[model samples]
Target: MRFFNTEGPNRADDHYSLPPLSRWDLDAILTLIEQKKYFLLHAPRQTGKTTCLLALMDYLNREGRYRAVYANLEGAQAYRENVDAAMAVIVTDIAASARVWLGDTDAPVLAREVLATTPHGSALSLFLAHWCQRIPQPMVLLLDEVDALVGDTLISLLRQLRAGYPQRPDAFPQALILCGVRDLRDYRIHASSEQAPITGGSAFNIKAKSLRLGDFDAEEVATLLHEHTAETGQAFTPEALARVWELTQGQPWLVNALAYEACFEQPEGRDRAQPIGVDLIDRAKETLILNRVTHLDQLTHKLREPRVRRIIEPMLGGTALGEAFEEDREYLVDLGLLRRDGAGGLVIANPIYREVLPRALASGPQDSLPQISPTWLNPDGSLNPDRLLDAFLAFWRQHGEPLLASAPYHEIAPHLVLMAFLHRVINGGGRLERAYAIGRGRMDLCLRDGAVTLGLALKVWRDGRPDPLTEGLTQLDAYLAGLGLDRGWLVIFDRRARQPPIEARTSSHETLSPAGRCIQVVRA
Candidate 1:
């Protein structure tokens, strides 16, 4: 039976998938290939770039217009700076793909022979030239994960392609498409022997255009869910369908993984008689996040990168990044970590990601938190806001300092530690939602347990900045009003150079907002 595929390129008969070609401008792509133009196709990992390339190769070969092959150069990554070894593997892989897809053995044999006799720098070019000469039709090559080859290997491959570009359609491949997670121009190839970094554009200036494969649109997402319904007679409730879209924002891997988990993994989900509902979808999303599934984990791992940190730190902390953050912002957007919201401001790509980022950042602190009794729960199992406040006050006074020191993102250490404490308190039976934006100067968190809801706003008083007490109270007032609550907490974190220690400063006092709503002010 066909299922949502999470592993690799989707096969029509084996997986429920959207049409690959429909995801891009097929006419524009064909025009590039027909014009013998070398170009690029890039998108975030697991977004189906490989699937689209495979489909395009199959289409071109079946149409008998071009002898097309899709070659994955990822295997050559192990050779790193060994240009000769990497190129040999890449050339052999391309030849093997050509023979498998086009059923032409002569091309592979001749190409391998040429690689054996050619110099290390010109080996790939000579092999491609020999292979193209043997083929009757013009060759179209899609080199997948081209950027995976680093240092001297990457430089050699790009240079070879450029060296052979002028002889296309007869001597070299008629057209070439390089596919990877980022644009070729974004690559900063560092060779061990070179003192300066070599940009990919300098190596391959012949690129005609860059095409990005996007995530599924709302309709496409719905169509994929509908395919499961059509096949199994089990329907997704309207809310569940919408929830999936909201959580995934049409990210292809996430859409498939969530559906697969809902319909197959959970025992309750496997019951065909039971229709999928929003609650089930929510559970699936929680499972995906907490377990740190491969895709989401891979994304969060990028948080440690300096470039990624510059863009993400400010978004998480609700402050503006430096003036030089534009390139980093664009880089994060290209990696699918950040997206341009309707207002053109950068935000986490989706609701799931919004939740994932902070939680992942706080995971270390959360794990280190000392055990505490559930003093916040009443006899009837409802959370008591006053009791929770007492627990947070005591916990913050005791462990907050050590925990903050352990947080990965230093700028938001206090916030991470607080969220970690709250996450521990609310783990099994409650929900915590976060909202923050660049220049907002605050992070708002809403915690819900059964019928009880609590709103807490967090702000930092950094060096050269005024105390955020008044601003936070006003912000908390609006936030509480939005949540339809008459009370909430405004937490001001003093981060000035000469501020008192956290233990000495940790305290809370009752205050009133400008709108006359009761507010609990926590100075930590």
Candidate 2:
């Protein structure tokens, strides 16, 4: 009866689950609690932080060493417009959770009494002070989705907790853990009491540490899948496991989603008894991405956020503004969109995410448009860039005007359209690596056709600038230097210099520099 859990917390009986506490770094967390230290627990959405905290709460409460409660403040989202209303909901939710777990409904009454008596600016701190005074054992509070509260409400919560820090073990919660997608340090909150910026370090100043719950390791992922094999006598071939890891990079939701699709959704022919293999995983990836399921859709919805766009645009352009790069880079990493690359800097988190995102964000035409023929691909499994780009240029001349007319992604339409065209051709055959960045001069794309590696560098020009041979040659030289490539192709999207209708668009290849390296220029 066990199944993959794509939704909320996994149950031992209903879902194939990991050993309680086995999936998290619980020892470190417990050490913080024992030392009376406040800390952070964060990871991308649905990566099991809430589940881990709930389990930890149970362990602590059942041990009878402390009173622990896990409370989600997300319900306070509605109070975003009214600070007083938001505070009331927060206090009530905390009280309700405490009542259920601590056998203390009166907790709220005492908290409200404290708030009524305390000074206007410090009500929450005083309320927590009162509640802590009445509780018998030391308390461990796990605040989930604390980042969901915006502006002042967030500041109040952090400041209140900070104010109550000195009363640990008596009148305050010992071992407070704040959980959200962002670390506490990223919180930018300002309050009426202080005109200056309130760094999280100052507001939640007592935090002894910030601990991010990481995704499962590859071995752990295999072990999770293996449990199903043990129970149902079905097996996952080694190739399948590798495919899953390559695609998901051990992301929890993705891991579960791939397995769910392969085992349950794949056609029976492909889901045969011969241990599930790489082909099945590939098929699952294609089907899931093409279908645009709720989980994938929700994650991409973040693309509309300005912060997300700021980070993503540079990646699409293959260059990033150096200033403040680290902070935004860390934010994207925490979002699970990018991961550290030992030598290559930061790369997209995984192949599946890389493949899914562009398509997911591509406008309506890309999704609903007619499929391009595979005629451009050679029988030797090679893509003739000269032919492909030329053919695409012709197609663009004919339909690009119409497509770009209604395209909402006007600034990046050229890139998306080309990517979509390439994706259609390489849909089932090869992998295309997309590297673009906001304000970065060029978009670098690497096409891997088994043994052949082709690099395409695209530069965008706004005005009718003269031929960019000198600048383009220099940039290409630097890019080729890093890529260890000798020759490559460059496509320039000159906003003011489109080919004269039907008669002028053409592709030309020529040698550049004393080295006489080949570079193709496709003017469209």
Candidate 3:
């Protein structure tokens, strides 16, 4: 039976997948290869880069024009700065791939001998030179995870590839495709022998173009889900299909993971006759976020890097990004953590990431809180918005300061702490949706539980800024109108240097918005 694949490269025979080559401009890529131009293929991890490269290799070999091989260079990462050791592993892997995919044993045999005799720095170029010379057809090499090797190993590989570019067809591969999570221009390698960092562009100046493998389009996403319905007769409701696309924004791993969880992992969904619904998809999204699965966890880990933090901090704070933040913004876009919205403003890459970022940031603060009763939940377990507000006020008065200190993104600590408390309130029975963006000056949240839906707008009062109450109320009015609720909360966190203590200043007042929606204004 075919299933959604979340692991390595997807095999069409075993996994439900979109056509790999369909995600790229195949004509352009083929033109590059035909011209013998070395180029790059890059995308975030688990986005089908390997699958596409393997498909291209197969297509090239079947055309009877080139001897094509795809090799994963990740194995060389273990050797780190040991260039010679790394080159040996890389050469061996390339040979193994050639034998498996191209039925070429002679190339590996020759490569092993050549590598044995070559020096550390020039070993890769020498081995490739010998192997290509022996091949019957012009060689097309696809090196996957090319950026996985760090330090001297990475510099050596790129430099060697560049050095061999002048000798083509007969002495070196006719066309080389390097694949990794980021473009070559973004790579910063610190070689032990060099005093300064070497940019990948400097090391590999021969790159013709960098082609990115995009996520599935809406039509492609529908086609993948339909495969399951066609096979098992267990259909996804139209709403479920739309929800999946909205949540994932066509991110490959997220689309597959959410579907797999909803249709395969959930016990209720195991009955083949049952249709998958929007609620089930929502549950699956929550499950993935709460578990911090490998893919999402890997992204969260990047938040610690200073470059990553610079972009993320301003984003969460809703402040304007400075000119200096441009490079970092581009870097995050390449990593698939952020993307340009239609208006060209920066936003989280997708809804799932938008949800994951704050939740992951709040995890530390959430862990430090003391056990408290779900005071806002009614006897029948329905959420009471007014009671919830009262409970939050009490919680903030007593414990909010310490929890804020515990948050990882200090610029948005108050927001994170509030979210952590609200998450605890709605843990089992409800869902929370967050929306924030660069220069928005506020964060909007919507909480849903059964028939109760609450809208909230959060603003921070920073130095030299007036109290944001009037603006916040206007925003909350618009937010409540969108949520179809007549009442909502506008939380203004006072973050100025000489503010009174939180316990003494935190208070709430009720007011009417310009739209006349009842607004509960909370000052913390």
Candidate 4:
């Protein structure tokens, strides 16, 4: 039976797949190859690029039009210091893959001989030239994880492929597909003895196009799940599917992760036969974020990359960076990190990602902190604005300094703390509605209990001011209007000055608004 493929490549008939090669835009890729165009296929890690390539290789070879071979160069990357060792590894891997594909181990004899005769500096190019001469039919070469190579090794591979580009159909690979996370322009290759970049584009200018393997579409996701249901006689509840769509937004890893967790890791009392629902998905999302695995951590690592931060930081601040947003927003969309919402605004792709992003970016002594439930100020289940604000003030008094001092994402510390506190309070008990976009105004959190709801707008004032109340009131008014609520609370942290020691006392009171909505302030 086929299991969820969280790691490694999926073979042709071994995995329960989305048609084995159903990633959208396959037609365009095949068209590019048929036209004898060399191109690049790029996508973030684990979005099924390898699976797509394997299926494509099968299709081409089965058609008997040309000899196609797909080899991943990642294994050779570890031998960076020795070019000969690296080249030999690449050749050995390629020969092994070629033999499996074409039933002939000697198919690349010319390629091997050229590498043997050419000097170290020019071996790669010479090998490609010789390989083209030996292969009778046109060749299609698919290089996976091509970006793992660094320095001279990477440049040599590109240069060799480029040198043999002119000898298509009769000799060199008719189409070469280079696959990696980012394009060649972003690569900065420095030779061991050289201080400056090795100029990658000069060696690999033959790229006719760059194609990204995108996340699954909504329909594609539904089809994949439905296929499993058809085989196992199980079903995902309609709400569960909607929740999956909402939380994952069709990112493949997330889709598979949520499904696997829901099926195998259900809470002790939950029913197994009934379809999983949205609430269960919400719970699964919480578990995934709180106890992050490697796949999620990898995306969080990109936050430090300027291209990612250029679009993310402003969102955290609730404002947009008009000029600094030069990176392709669509590329972020393709990577499944950001997406255009119904309002056409760019936000973190989905709720699971939204929750994980902040926690992942926050560095220092955090995960060790106890996960404590919020002490509700209201007796009846509804949040008392005055009491909730006071609770935060009290918590911040004791733990704020130490936590913020060690925090890596200090700029967003207050928001993270407040969210973490709120999550503890209402998590699994009631609903907490959170809506934040890049560079808007303030982070809005609505704590709900049946018909009653309490909204709090958390803002940071870096300016040298003792009070942000007046400025916060204006923003809170707009937020309340959007939420259709008459009254809410504002929690403003005065970061410009050192907060008074916990030994001092503070007061909480209700300030009435012109709209008759109640405003409470907790001065800590």
Candidate 5:
């Protein structure tokens, strides 16, 4: 059975996949290749860049217009800055690819000859020149993992390519496409011997264009899910289909991982008679996050980077990122951690990411939390808002300070600490959802525990900032309206300078909002 693939590049015979060429501008690619232009095909780690490149190579070769060979340069990564060793690995890999893809057995022999006669710095260039000279058809090189090399190795590869750019189909490949996770311009390659960083652009300015392989759109997501139904006679309910799109926003890896979890791994999902539903999709999402699967784990790992933290911390706490924004924001967008929304503003890529990021950040604090009774639960098993608020106040007074120290991002420590507490409150039965955005000055959370649901808004009162009470109440009022709840909590963290210790000032009170909605105000 064809299934959603999570481990690696998609293969048509085994995996359910869309046409790779449809992900980007095929005409533009054709134009570049026809013009004998060197360019880049880049995207996030698992957005199917390799799949697209392989497909392009196959398409080009089948047309008999160009002899296209796809080679992965990841083997060179092991050699690091050893330019000579890395060149040997790359040349041999290209030769192997040519033998397999083009049925050309002589390329491997050419590789050994090239390495022996040519200098390490120019071995790749010399090898490519020799291969093109041997081949009758104009050759195209689709080089994957172009960004895998570091320092001098990367510099040498780029420079060699640039040096050979003037030679056409006879002396070098007619066209070359470098594929990796970032654009060539994003690489600030620093050689060990050089005092300053060298940008990839300077090393290889021959790139004519940069093509990004993008995620699937909504229709593509639905088409993939329905493919299973067509094949197995099992269906996804309308709600489940919409839920998948909502949670994933058409991110290819996420879309596949969620479906693979729900349809294959989950015991009940294996029965073709039982259709997939929203509940199952929700469970699948939870499973992916809880299992800390490779994809999610890698996504969270990126959060530790300072460049990532600068934007994410403010997004988590719902405040402006200040002036340190421009280039860093672009970097995040390129990394696929954030995206340009319909309004041209940056947002956490999708809903699932929005949930996973904070939870990952709070995992440290969540682990160190002290034990407490489920005092917030009523006899009937639903949550009691009043009781839950009381428990949180007590928990904050006793352990909040120490727990704050465990949080990874200190700027949003209070938010993480509270999220940690709520995660405990769920006790495996409910979910806590959060919504925060840059420059919003508020973080809204909704807790759904069985029959009970509570809405809460979090705000931080910083040293130079005005009190967030009025702002938070208004925000919570809007939030409650969205959740269709009349009453909710507004918890404001007092981070102002010289503030009293947490225990003495942590308190709550009931108040009426401007909209006359009932709100419990917690000042901690």
Candidate 6:
């Protein structure tokens, strides 16, 4: 039976799949190859790059114009700056792939002879030169994980590819495509041998164009989900289908993982007689995040990087990104954490990422939280908003100061801590929904449990800013109106110098918004 593929490359017979080549500009790829150009095809990791390269190789070979081979260079990453060692591994991997997939008996033996003769810097160029001599058709080399090579190793590989650029069709490969998580130009290798950083552009100046592989569009996403229905006779409801698209925004691994979880992993979802619904999709998403599935974990792990932080921190804190932070926008987009909106503004890539980022940031403080009674839970188990606020007030009065240090990003520490506290309350049975954007000056949250949805808007009183009490109330009013609520919470974290300690000045008072909604204002 065909199932959603969550790991490695997709297999047509085993997995409900899409044609990999359909995800890119096919005509452009063919044109580049026909013109004997070297280029880059990059996308975020685990987004079917290997699948695409393999499909392209098959297409080229079947057309009988090019003897195409695809090799993943990730294994060579272990050698770091050792150019000879890295090059040997690269040659061996490529030659083995050609032998196994293309049924070529000469590549392996020829590779050994070349390795014995070529030096560190020129080995790949010389190897390709020799291999092209033996093949009748022009060679099209698809090198995957090109960015995995580091330092002098990466430099050497790029230089060698560039060195072979002039010898195409007859001596060198006719067309070479480098595939990786980021574009080749973004690679800034710290060359130990050169005692300086070598930019990828300088090393491989012959690159014709860089084409990025994008996530599946809405229709493609539906095509994949419906494939499961066709195979198993278990269908996804319309809302479930839309939910999946909303949550994943057509990210390949996420789409597959969510569907796989709902259709196969969860016991209730395993019953083919019962159709999947929005609730099941939500559960699958929560499981993927809470369980720290490899794809989400790997992407979130990048959140700790300083470069990533420089781009993401401002968005979380609701402050304008500094002019300098603009440089890392493309990098973050390449990482798949953020995407450009229709208006060209940067936003978290999708709903799933939106939830995961805050949840990930709140994890540290959540773990640090001390034991507290579930005063927020009613006798029947529904959430009690007043009691929930009381619990937060007491917890913050006692532990808020120290727990701030536990937050991973300092600019968003208060937001994280408050979220951490609420997460502890809701972990039993609820959801915390959040919305904050760059330069928005406030973060809106909706806490849902059973039939109750408690709305909130969080603001900060920084060094030179005013008390923010009025602004907080107005923002909370708008947020509550959106949620169709009459009242909610407005939390203003005071960060100015000479502010009173939590024990001394933390307080909550009732106020009315301009719209006359009752707002409970909390200042700490």
Off by over 4 Å in 4: 11-14, 80-82, 107-116, 185-200, 267-272, 304-311, 322-335, 340-345, 362-387, 423-433, 447-454, 464-471, 474-487, 497-508, 513-515
Worst 10 residues of 3 by lDDT: 192-201
Residues 228-343, candidate 5, lDDT per residue (tens digit)? 89889999999999999999998999999999999999988898999999999999999998999998898999999887898899888887788755767877887788999999
Off by over 4 Å in 5: 191-196
**Global CA lDDT of candidate 1, please?**
0.88
Pairs clashing within candidate 3: none
Q: Which predicted model would earn the best lDDT?
A: 5
Ranking by lDDT: 5, 1, 6, 3, 2, 4
List model 2 lDDT by residue over 441-475, tens digit each.
77777776655567777776666567655566677
Please state the error at residue 126 of candidate 1 in Å: 0.4
**lDDT for each candidate structure:** 0.88, 0.73, 0.88, 0.71, 0.90, 0.88
lDDT of candidate 3 over 1-524, digit per residue (tens): 99999999999999998888888888998888889999888899889999999999989989989989999999988888888888889888988888899888786787778777777678778888888888788999999998788887888888898899989988999999999988756356766555356564587778888888888888888999998998789999999999999999999999999999998999877888899999899989999998989999999999998789898877887877775456677779989998888988788999999999988888888888889788998899888888998999999999988888899889899999998888898876788899888888899999888889989999999999898999888888877888889998999999999888999999999999999988899999
Error of 2 at 104 (Å): 4.6
Report the alpha-carbon TM-score of model 6 versus the true structure: 0.97
Global Cα lDDT for candidate 5: 0.90
**lDDT tens digits, residue span 22-93, model 6:** 998899899999999988988998889999999998899889989999998999999988888998999899
Question: Residue 14 in model 2: shift from native, Å?
Answer: 1.6
lDDT string, candidate 4, 1-524, tens digits: 44445676765355547865667477887788889999988877777888888888988888888778898888988987477777766766776678787776574665467567766556655555556567776888898888888777877777767777887756677888988876555345667556466674677788898887777788877877676576565677888888888788888778877776766576621344677677777777766665677778887877876667777766876766677643456557656788777888788877877777766654343543454445654666665555666666677666665666554455666666666666556655656666778765667778776566887887766666446677677778877998889888877655665656532534456786556678886553
* Candidate 1 Cα misplacement greater than 4 A, ranges: 186-188, 192-196
